[model samples]
Target: MEIVEFGSDDSGLVARFVDVSNAVRRHDAPWQHLQTVHAATGMLRHGWDGEPAVPFLATHGGDDVAAGEWHVGNYDNLHIAWLTVDVHPAFRRRGHGTELLEALVDRTRSAGRTSVGGDGWDNELSRSFAARHGFEQKAVEVNRRQLLAEVDPALVDRLHAEAAAVAASYELVRCPARTPDDQLPVMAEMVSAINDAPIDDLDIEDEVFNAERVRAYEEAHAGRGITLHRLVARHRETGELAGQTVIGVDRERPHLGNQHDTSVVRAHRGHRLGLLLKTGMLQWLREVEPQIEEIDTWNAESNNFMIDVNEMLGYRIVGRALAFQKSLA
Candidate 1:
């Protein structure tokens, strides 16, 4: 097996890598939504979340058989490297994945990193690989999906009403398709609230969020043809941003949307702002993107508060995934 490192500019090879990765995901977890090559390429080329990617392709018989991408976090977690290795289902069990993983870990160690992190299905094969490779199970992330068609619009309205009753001091701001300039700074603060999410045993740093990072994130999504719908709660008294939630809908796949980053700052947690933000966006989507059928979200299993909110909003667990990490001793 020949492992060749592919550069960010190699769009052809990166597209092939995305093909292989999507194939693996579909075959391994059919319930999960497949990612777009455009998004993967954008992340690799543009470093979404401020982490540059190093992609490797494994070639055999003059064909790109398997692929892996290693990303070293630069924002705040420089000591950790995250890698995803996907061997085409047809090429699995031939030692390609093992080779790619070993090479990724070696590269991370060479870069003076302390640990390597990756996520995988909770299936037996993935669990066994992590066990055999000395990767410690750090956390379990639950992937949940909500069918919008089955969602009762009245439920959202009722939730909105209930939240409104208690959250009277907070005003909800709805930003469709783009973030307003006036809200950019507070949006950065809300983005930083994600750092409060349970990281479990994963050795990583808190992401630094500012207007610049928000713009880069917006650009990356736009490059992938994804439109974002956001709802942010602000305290009417102090004019402080309390909480926010975002839903991303792909133009190519209008039937599916992604639930990303629903967070409430520490000072504003007890006011049911999370429910307000989520339901507010759901109501907006019902009006704007009625074609969206389902929205998927992932949360750490330990996040009972968020899970409770999701459960209340009709999101059910579809699959279990694991985050694994290995320390370079």
Candidate 2:
């Protein structure tokens, strides 16, 4: 087996990578959308927040067998690297996955990272593989999806109205596409509220967010051809941003949407802002992105607050994933 790193410019290799990814998705997560070449290229080039991962393709006997990437954060979690390994369904049990993982671990250690983390669908195969590799399960996450066709407008209206009444002191502000330059500062501050979410014993640090980081995030999404629809709640009197919810709609696949982050500042909790923000987003998307069919989101199993809100909005559990970590030290 041979492993070689490839850049975004190498369209041939990128397409091969997407092929393996789609193959794995079909076998492992048939309900999930397939990956497109354009989206994969953008991800390889722009990454999540302008920090692209180092992607590698493994080939055996002139046939592509596995794909992997190692991602390290520049702003926070500086001591750890996140890894992903996807083996072609037809090529599994041939030691391709393990070999690719070994290469990723080597790169992680060479990057001076003390810990490495990876996540996979909850299954005996995934669990035993991690355990055999000396990794410990640290957290569990539930993936829930909302199908627009099944949502009740009457329910959404009632919830939004109830939340609005309770949060009468605040107003919802619609921010479509990219955030304005003037709002980056406040957006950064409010985005940091995600730090309050449950980590479930994962060895990580609070992500540092600022104006620059916010800009980078918007740009990265734009580069991936995703239109960002963000709804923020602001205090009526003080005009401070209290909470926000963001959804990204894919341009290439207009029927698909992703739930980004929904958070409220610690001082502003207990006002039903979470419900207000999410319900407001649903209403706003109805008008702007009626083409969207399904939206997916993930939450730590321990985050009952957010899960309750999601469930109330008709989000149903689609799958569960396990996060595993290994200390390189």
Candidate 3:
């Protein structure tokens, strides 16, 4: 068995990595959309918030059998490294997964990270794998996809109206594909509201956000051929940013959309901003992106508030994922 590190520039190896990943996805989670080489290439080159994970591909007897990655945040959670190991379905039970995991753990420790974390679909196979590695389940996250075609237009109108009535003191602002130069400051501050979301027992720190990070996020998404639509709620009198929701539609797969974030500032709670932001986004997408068939989102099972709003918006569970962590110490 041999393991080799790769970057986005290595087109040949990256293609092999995508093949292994798509195979794993098809076997483990067929409900997921298959990955495209173009999207995978962009992700490897420009990761979330501009911090790309280090990728490794493993081969045995000249056949690629598995892939792995190790990622750490540049702004926060400096002591932990998030890792992933995916063995081709046909290659499972051959010790490829264990070999790849051991290599990734070594890299994590070499990076001075004291803890490593990863997530997989909540299934007996995944659970047993984590348990065998001495990793503990830290949290469970539900993947929900809202089918736009199944949504009732009247129900959306009614919900939007009801939320608008409660949030009468605020107005929605439609941001462009890229946030304007002036709003980046407050937008950075507003993005931090996501920290309030529950993490369960995960040992991680609140992500640090700033104007630069916001720009990086937008750039990263753009690089992946994703069109971003952001809607922000502002106080009518004080002109402050009260809350916001962001959704991204892939230009390559225009029929599918993704829910990025929907957060309400702490002081602006109880005004139904979460509902307003999400419902308003749906209405806007109908006008601008009428071809979108579904929008996918993930939320911690412990996040009842967000879950309630998602349920009200017609989002249904597709699957649940289990997060697992182990201390290298």
Candidate 4:
């Protein structure tokens, strides 16, 4: 078996990697729940404008058989994000995962990064691999899903009414497609508020979630998969952006939903804008994306406010995962 590093807008090979990855874990997610070819290629080519991510494809027999999508960032915290390996069921235990991982870790050490971090579901393949590599289970992330089919329709209506009444001083607006170029700067500022939320064991550098990185996130991952609707609420008279919620649909198979983000600006708190924005967006999602069967979201376990809101909305815990780390030294 041969391991070859592929880079610089290798769209076709990247698509092949995604295909193999999807095929292997095909049933794990409700829908495909992944970026389309264009989105994946965009990341591979110039994610964060060459900020130290090198996606690799493992190939043999004139066919690209295995793939790894990983990032070698400062993590702005001296770590990594979403570091997962993909080996076709036909090619498991063939050592491709190890090769690709080692390559990135080696690169991180050489680049002066201080640590390596990763996360995976509380499933065998993930936990076993982490144990074998001496990575400890440092923190766990719990995932919860609320079945729209089981949720009380009347409750959704009442929540909408109460929330709308409280939020009446603001206007709920969904920016169709991307925000205009003129709005990008404020969008950046508004988006930065997200970092204010909680991340328990992940050593995320709080202040590093700045305008630059926020815009990078908005551009890279925001508007993909299904209808990417970023619902923002602006003060009615002042026209100042007050709160926001983003709901996503699985474009290929519309029945699945992902709550990308829901937040209220510091000043916008106390008004229940968080609840208002979320329920409003949920209503929009239900009506327009009715086929959506499941909507999943996560927050730090200690985040009582958001979790309470989610509980009220009927989101039930589904699975748990740990974000683990190892020092490169």
What is each predicted model's overall lDDT from 0 to 1?
Answer: 0.85, 0.93, 0.93, 0.71
Off by over 4 Å in 2: none
What lDDT would candidate 4 get against the real structure? 0.71
> Cα RMSD (Å) per model?
1.9, 0.9, 0.9, 3.9
Task: Flag regions of model 4 displaced more than 4 Å.
Answer: 7-12, 23-53, 59-66, 73-82, 87-96, 165-169, 207-226, 236-240, 286-291
Query: Could you tell me which residue pairs clash in candidate 4?
Result: 226-251, 255-291, 255-292
lDDT of 4 by residue, 1-329 (tens): 57666775676777787777676656344333554676566557656423535677778787676777667654355544446666776766777667777776777677777677777766788787788887777777778898898987789889988988877798888776456767877776676677778776665575454445544555554333445778898999988888788876646656777777777789878888888887887778766777889888877667788888899999988767667777766
| Residue-by-residue lDDT tens digits, candidate 3, 192-295 | 99999999999999999999999999999998888999999999999989888999998999999999988999999999999999989999999999999999
Choose 1 or 4, whichever is better by lDDT.
Answer: 1
lDDT ranking, high to low: 3, 2, 1, 4
| TM-score of each model, paired residue for residue | 0.93, 0.98, 0.98, 0.78
TM-score of 4: 0.78
lDDT at position 102, candidate 2: 92
Error of 3 at 35 (Å): 0.7
Cα distance off (Å), candidate 2, residue 75: 0.3
Worst 10 residues of 2 by lDDT: 175-184
lDDT of 1 by residue, 1-329 (tens): 88988765788887788788788888999997776776677667666544567888898887677888888755567788899888899888888889889999988989999888898999898899898899989999999999877788999899989988889999998865567787678788878999999989887778888887888788777766778887889899998888889998888888999998999999988888988888898888888998999999999999999999899989999999999998886
Looking at model 1, residue 248 earns an lDDT score of 85
